[model samples]
Each structure stands twice: as C-alpha cells, then as structure tokens.
Target: MTDQAPAPAINADRLWSRHMEMARIGPVEETGNCRLALTPEDVEARNLFARWCREAGMELTSDRAANMFARREGRDPARAAVAAGSHLDTQPHGGRFDGVSGVLTALEVIETLKDAGIETDAPLMVVNWTNEEGVRFGPGILGSAWFAGRIDDATLDDIRATDGARFAEEAAASGWRGTATPADLPMEAFFELHIEQGPMLEQAGADIGVVDAVQGLCWLDVAVTGMDAHAGTTPLPARRDALLAAAAMLVGINDMGRASGEDARVSVGRLKTATEGPSTVVGASEFVIDIRHPDQAMIAHLQEECRRVCAEVARRYGCGVEVSQRFAIPPTAFDGGCVAAVEAAAQALQLPYRRMASGALHDAANVAAHAPTSMIFVPCRDGISHNVAEYASREHLAAGANVLLRAMLAKAG
Candidate 1:
C-alpha cells in the first residue's frame, strides 16, 4: 500500500441534516419517501441537488441521457476525473436512503474537499444518475446504461413509463439535460455509497460493507392457460385447476431458489389471474419471477430449472404453460483495486465491516462497464427497502459517508 495523505473529515450532523431535508420532498407520512424516476418529484429532487452542488462551488453538467454530474477539477487538466455517486430516483414507495443516500454521500465528499480547498491530481465528479428505479419507465439503470454506451439513442427515446410518457419527453421536461456525450464520462475511477437494503450488515452487527460484486438479475414472466368451467358443475377429478397449479408452481419456485444456497435470491413480485368471478374457474394466470445470483451460469441454470418445473406442474394439472424471460443482466464484479480502497478506508476508520457482494442492482454496476468502480454499503433497518418501512440510522449514514470520502480522495489523488 502506498502512503497517502489523510483525507478531510466530513460533518456527520450536516450530512444527516441534508438527508432529512431531501426526504421532505416526497415524504410518506414521515417514515419514508417516494420520488419516481423522471416525474415531477424527480425533477424537484434534481433541482435541489444541483443547487446544493452549486453552493459547494462545483460546476454542473448533464449528459444526453440526462445524467447529472457535479465536477471539481484537479491540478492536472489531462487526467480523468475520479467520480463518486449514485442515482437520486426512488421506487414509488421507496425509503429515504435507498438511492438518495448514495447521491448525498458523494455530494458530501465533494463538499468536504471544497470546504478544505483541497486539490488533487485528477478532477472529481459527484454524479446523480437518472431513473435507476424504472418505477415510472424502466428496465431501470437507463441513465447509466446510456452513459456507458450500452443503450442507443433510438431505444432510449422510445422508452415509456407507466403513464405512457416518453422518456425523452420526460427527461427534457426536467430541464437538466446536457449536451455532453458518453465520451465525456471516462473517469479514472468511480465509487458509490449506498444502504445495503438487506439484513446482512445489521444481522452481523457491522458498521460498513465493502462490496466486491453485484449479482446477475433475470426477469421471468410465467403464464398458465386452462379451460374455464362453472364451479358448481365441474367435477373435482375431471376439472383442470389453473389456480391449484399456480400455487404448486409458486412453491416449486421457492424450492428452486433454495437450491442455489444463501447467495442466490429469487421472488415472485407480481401475480394476476384472468377471471373475476368467484364461481367461474380461473382460466389463466400470469406472474413474474425475479432472480439474482453472483454466478452467471448458476442464474441461467436456475432459469432453466424454473422453466422445467413450470412445464411439469402444468402437465400434472392438465394445463399449458409458457415462460418468457423478458430481461437479464449478468452479474457485475467491481474493480479489485477500487474495492481495496473501500476496505482500507473502513480499516482506517476502525469501523466494523464485512466484505460482501451486492444482491441488488445498482448504478455502480453499469459504471463498472465503463470505468473502475466499487461500492460502500451501510445497514438499513431489517434489510428492507423500496417500501414505506425502510429505515437507516443517522449515525450509520454518516459512517458510510466518511468511508466514501476517504476512498474517493485516494482515487482522486
């Protein structure tokens, strides 16, 4: 390890204060927040974030994808910027800190450096990625994907949210769009500090989490078809029961998830039946299976297993089944050197931390495709997120920010 200059400390109180203030934008009865991507609430959050960065004396820029960056230049004009931050958008029922915490922590890093008037070898950038939640219009991480060149102009423009509002129109409606292209985001390194959104850290009583990689994710939409029949007249032995088959499939899906061990994650997030009347036997069923695993091959294998299970269950129930995998992203591994910085930062602070992998998809995963990237995780209450019950302590939030500050400074220097 190289001897490095000590980074300036951040103000915990100020950080917490800013967090509460930001939470007020879309508060849900005082417990959580809700700011859907590219909506009016999203625009409100972006404007405030830009104002805060401006107050910190940072120059702001937006990309064609509408991703925001607050830049603090370095002594060497030729070096790539060292970046930190995450998205500011939230799920419809998201907690205050899910994505917002990462954005604020990065801003705190920039503010701490600016307050100290410190200059480094490379420019520093604090980014606020757009639309990470896809709650409005998604496949989430659209902003980061576009900035990384994984998405093209036509596709990005064609995206529509639940309200049928085009992504291009909504992004432009925010008025934060920039003329810069993906070519402008070639950073030397990027870091993100976010809440774990899981119980692991809290369960282990760790103060910080050094994230090494993110799990691959796949979305499966399953449907079962059967003949509709009258509940009074259909014989139990003769009738094909779609609902019963669907219940069996759900149990089978849970079993498949368990076969992958503790590292794998799977859940059925949504389900719908075709019939409305109680007397009529359900004719069809549709549901979505969400899965995450560190290994790409394992995730694929599990998908296949799910398909096989669905087929067998359908045959037993005398029904037809179809499974459609609509979306997938392979697992992402962070840069080892960048991850080391996070670990070192935690060690230097004497904060209890565990080296772990992120189960949730993050903007950092997308940034990793373009530059060296890593992440910091703090504990949230009960490992719950994207809901009104999500919670994290002020002290835990500050600890993660301080860790982010040191790691980011090392990269910037």
Candidate 2:
C-alpha cells in the first residue's frame, strides 16, 4: 500500500452545515425528522445527496432499489472500490443523526480527498442504502439485501407497506432508481460511521466504538383466539378471554427474556384487542414480538419456549394460540481485515475506542455478507435514537469522520 498524499483533514463546520441543510428537507415541527422510504421527502433527500456528490466530482451509480453509489475514481480501474455509508431513510419520528450522519460523513471524506487532490489505488464509494428503517416496507435493509442477493427482485418488488403501497410502485415513482443491478460492481471493503445509538460509548467515555458484531434478531407475530362473550354475563371462571391469555404470555416472555441475562432482549411492541365494548370479553388478540441475542442457539431455544408457553397459557384459558417467526437475522461478526483497519485508524488518530457488538441492526450487517465490512460509532446523547432527541456533539462527529477517512484510506490503498 502507498500514500498518494497525507489523509486530508475533514472540515467540521462544513460537515455540520451539510447535516443541518439536509435536515431541512424532511423538517418536522420542533426537532425530529420524518422521511419514510420512497416518500417525497426521501426523494428530495436523495437529490440533495446526489447534488453534493456531483459537486465533489463523484459519479452517481444506483440500483433498482435506489441504493445510490457515489464513486470517486482511483488510479487502478481493475481494483474494486472501498465503500462507506448508511441508509438515509428515517423513522416517522427519527432524529437527524441516526443514519444520515453516516452518509454525510462519507461525503466529507470525499470532499476532503477532493480538496487534497489525493487519489488511492482503488476507487472510493459512498452509498445511500434505501428503506433501511422498514417503516414503509420491511424487513429492513432492503437495498443491501438485494445488493447481496439475500433477497431476490421478485420478493422485494412484491413487498407492501401498511398503507397498501407496493415497493415497486414507490421505487418507480422515485425517479432515482437506476438501470445498474446491485451485482454490477464488486466492493473490496465497506465501513460505516454512525452514532452509537446506545448509552454504552457515552457511559464508557470512549471516543469511538469499533463494532465487531451485531446481535441476532427475531420478529414473531402471535395470535390468540377465544370465543367472545358478554363481559357482564361471563363470570371469571367461565371466561375464555384471549387478551387475558395474551397477558400471561407476555409476562412469561418477559421472564424468559430476563432468564437469559441482560444480553437477551424481548419486547411486545404492538398489540391489538379486537372485541371492544364496555361489556364485551376480548375474543381475539394479536401482537408482535421482537427478540435479540448474541447467541443463535439461545434465540432458537427461546423461540421454542415462547411457542410452548403460549400454547400452555392458551389451553389454560380455553383459547388457541399461534406463533409465526416472521423474520430472523442471525448474529453477524464483522470481517477481521475490516475491523483491523478501523482499529488501526482509531489508534493512529488517538481516539479512545472499544470493540463491542451492536445491539441494533445496520446496513453494514447486511453488506458484511458480500464484502469485508466494519463500523465506527460515535457517542449520541443519552443513547437516544429513532427519535427527535437523538444527538451527537459536533466535535465527536468530526473525530469520527477523521477516523472514517483514515479507515477508508487504509482499505482503499
């Protein structure tokens, strides 16, 4: 590996200014941002990013999923590009920094390189993955999944949002979708810079987080059924309330989650009780379960336990229960080569860092399957994310950007 020039310094002020400007596209009342996938806001955001990439002399290459790849050519055309970035789509009540920070940080790296007139042996790439939040259409990481061929075009196109809009229609209307397929180019290495989105780094007083792995995640849709009856006439002993049975199951799930220790996580984020009347017993109840752990075996064991427990509770209440595993993502360990690049960068930059596993899923996790991949996480205020309150100090963000710049340089060289 050779150095064409000293790693260019990132302009902190310029980077922050760009973030604030992008925030204006999906501006919310007081603070949070909302740019659900393929919405007008999302399209506008993509345009702005593309505009910036053009200004930096990077060419746009996108896929049908609208996964934007901004490339800065290198000296050698045969070598694949070293890539970095995160998705830009935000949650309905997302903060300004969650995924957007990663995108802008990569832009900063490109701008810095442009200013320095430095080029690497292999090309550099910044990607803006689409629909990572899965708020509009799930499961999340759609673009990266397609890029990796983990999900085929037919399945991705067939997906529909809660509002009944097909992903195909939305992608077609966005006008950003391109002719290039995800497999058109090979990625030599990929790195992402993001807010830790958790309290660990802040609490540890670390300057950066070198993510080594991501926890496994499972999503289950549970349904409980029982005969509806008049609440006033149905005595407790005679009642076969679905909601009651579900309540017990939730408690049991929580207990199971705790039984495995703090690393295990389980939550019932959504629940609906159908029989709604002052004197009506709930006949049917449905809810979604989200569970995460580092151990796949433990996750599988917990899944079976959930089914067995729910079935038992339903039997006791004279109800029927069904549990379906809607989605499952096994734990992912980042590539050692990619991880070493990040570590060396942090050490060279004199930024304190911790090697840890990410509790949340990220696009890096999906891309890791195809290329050597790693992540750099800066601290966010109080670990808040996916909300308007999400924040990371500008100083910290700049530090992360420098680390990213150095890491990408290390890989691309």
Candidate 3:
C-alpha cells in the first residue's frame, strides 16, 4: 500500500492566537482563569466556540446536559462518528491549556482535513463536555456523566453551585440546555488531546505522552464537630477542638498515602472551620480530601484507612465525625488499539513519546468506560495545573495536536 501523505503543516501562530484570545475571556492577569462550570463566563466561552465551529462550516448541537458537539459530516452519514475534543470549564483558578487546547486542537484538525480535501468514511465530531472541572458543581465530568447515563436529570437538576445557584436554572438561562440526549449520538471512537498537567514530558525531555491509564480517584468531604469553648479558658486536654482533630486526620491521610508507595496521593485542598473568632475554640471543621491511585484495591484500602483514622481521631477529640463521598471514579485504562494508533502516529512523525498514567482526573476517564478512548498529552511548564501559571510550550502544543490529527484520520479512514 502506498504511504499516506505527510501530516498537514499546522498553523502554530494561528492556533496560539486562538488560544490566547479565548484565555482572555475569564482572564485573571497573573493567575490562569476562573470560568467555573455553567457560569456566565463559561456561557460566553461556549458561545464563542459555537461561533468558531460555524465559521468552519461544522454543525453544532447541545445535549440536555449542555455538552456541545461540533460535527463535520463524512462520506457515509449513517455510520458512527470518530470523535475528539475535551472540556471547556475551568477550575477555580485553572490555566488555559488544560481543557481548552484539546477542544481548539480538534477544531484545528477538522479545518486541516477540510483544507487538505480529505474525506473519511465516518463523520468527525469535536466535543465540549460541561462541568469537567467540577469546581462549581462538586462532581467533575457532569456532561459525560449524564451522557453515559451515570447521572440522571433529577439528580442533575438538584445540583447547586458554590453560590447556591441551581444547575438547570443556569443552563436554561444560558440557553444551552437542549433536547438531545448524550447517548443518542453514535460514536465509534473518542480521543482527547490534553496537557500532561504534570512534569512527566518536560522532565523526561520527551515531546509527547500517549496515556495508558488514568488513576482512580476518590474525593471525600469530612466534617468534625466538637463543643466550642474559650481557647484561653479551656485547658488543651479538656477542649474538644474540631480543627485539631481535622489537622490530625490530614496528617494521617498523607502519611497513609506516602507509606502506600509512588502511585498513591492524598491532598486536603480545602479546609473550613466554624466560628472565625480567634479566641474561640473551633466547634466544627470540614475539609476535602482527594485521594488517587492507579490500583483499585489500593485506593479502597487507603479509603478504608482514612475512614478508620477519622473515626479514631474523632473519638480521641470527643467529637462527632461524618464522611461523604463527593466523587468516585475507578481507574480506567485506554483502549489498547487506540494506544497503539497514537504510538504509531508518533513513530511516523519521528517524535518521542512515553507511556504514562494520568494523575489528574479527566473527562476522558469517564468516556473510556463506554467508548474506545485514548488521550495524547503535551507537557506543561512546571507540572502545575488549576492555577494561572499553568503553561505549555508552542512546540509541544503543535506536536500533540498533530498526533491527534493523525490518530483521528487513521481511525476515521
């Protein structure tokens, strides 16, 4: 068989410009962005994306969960489509590239295919999954969750934002909630291009990453309640301090994960205590613990230990404790075939790639459950994410997008 033509010459300058312009929407000068899911800024970004898709002659559609799909029909309209893209929602202070690059790259891929006058056997689609950040809604991958039937309408309707705003109300106000169902569309394969969100590629001196699996994640919100007393008047042994118990639990959780080995990580990112008065002992304290591991059994073990530790700490402090699961997603491995395709594409392009597991949870983790899914990762500057300083080089971006383009073309063809 004759070899396929070389990958099209991607317009790096144009791509970077597009990314910069979009980044400015919810921009926070030194920090990254704050376009929380379903917020007004998020709505503005979606509108701009739809407009961009229309300019490229791609038909756009929104599902009931507010997931957006931009489509470019192929030779056979009846077959399942080859799809690519990522989420648009940002964390509280997320960087620009985390989710936006995947989306813009997918759009660029379609533009490249059209400009090259190439036709595939199946339709191509770019997706923008809503609430992937989960900063506002509490659950990440909200769109994909609803699409996969993992989340229902009633549950989604009841989800409230950090501002106590109802999800459905905001979606309707933005005019994004549509009649289409996520599962109604036929998808043959799904691919996502993203930043490594870690230092893997940069540290290894590699240009790209072909993700093999995503680590399992369990997010728990723990609350410790104790009797409030005067800090100066109450003896240390007599006080039932909630904050102290919480601090002990945090340290215990970290120690547990550290002892478990390299794949385990525990983070207590948010902490709140009742009664902001400095002199008053804390009556109640709540914190969010995010635990992740690639091994399912290990994650379970860690979680159990955490629960036991919390109970013990509460007992020691004479406080009541409660743990709630905010989010739980099992470890997910990418399709072997899709992984092979990405590897082959990298080899063809003479690029260096390493097989790595994603430490950060992504929408792809959810999609992989129901579809043959894989992801390509570019390197970030300092393995930083969910911040304004998150950055990736232009060369890395182009390389990742090219891999995405080739992989999608191969699958569609």
Write down the lDDT of every candidate, Cα atoms only: 0.88, 0.90, 0.87
Per-residue lDDT of model 1, residues 132-207, tens digit only: 9878877888899888888898899889889998988888889977788767767999999989988999999999
- Rank the candidate models, highest lDDT first: 2, 1, 3
TM-score ranking of the models: 1, 2, 3
Candidate 2 regions exceeding 4 Å error are 1-6, 157-173, 225-238, 311-320
- Provide the global lDDT of candidate 2 against the true structure: 0.90
Q: Which 10-residue window in model 3 sums to the lowest lDDT? A: 1-10
For model 2, residues 1-413, the per-residue Cα lDDT tens digits are 45555577899999999888988988776778999999999999999999999999999988878889999999997899999999889999998998999999999999988888788889999999999998989888888888888898889888998789988888888987787875676889999888999999999989899998888989899999998999777799898899999999999989877887878888998999997886889999999989888789978987887888888899999999989999898999899998898999889888899988899999999899888999999999999998898888899999999999999999888
With candidate 3 superimposed using the best TM-score fit, by how many Å does residue 260's alpha carbon deviate from the native? 1.6
Q: Clash number for model 3? A: 2
Question: Over 4 Å off in model 1, which ranges?
Answer: 1-4
Evaluate residue 411 in candidate 3 and report its C-alpha lDDT on the 0 to 100 scale.
84
Which residue pairs collide, candidate 3? 31-388, 32-388
Q: lDDT score of model 1?
A: 0.88
lDDT score for residue 59 of model 2: 95
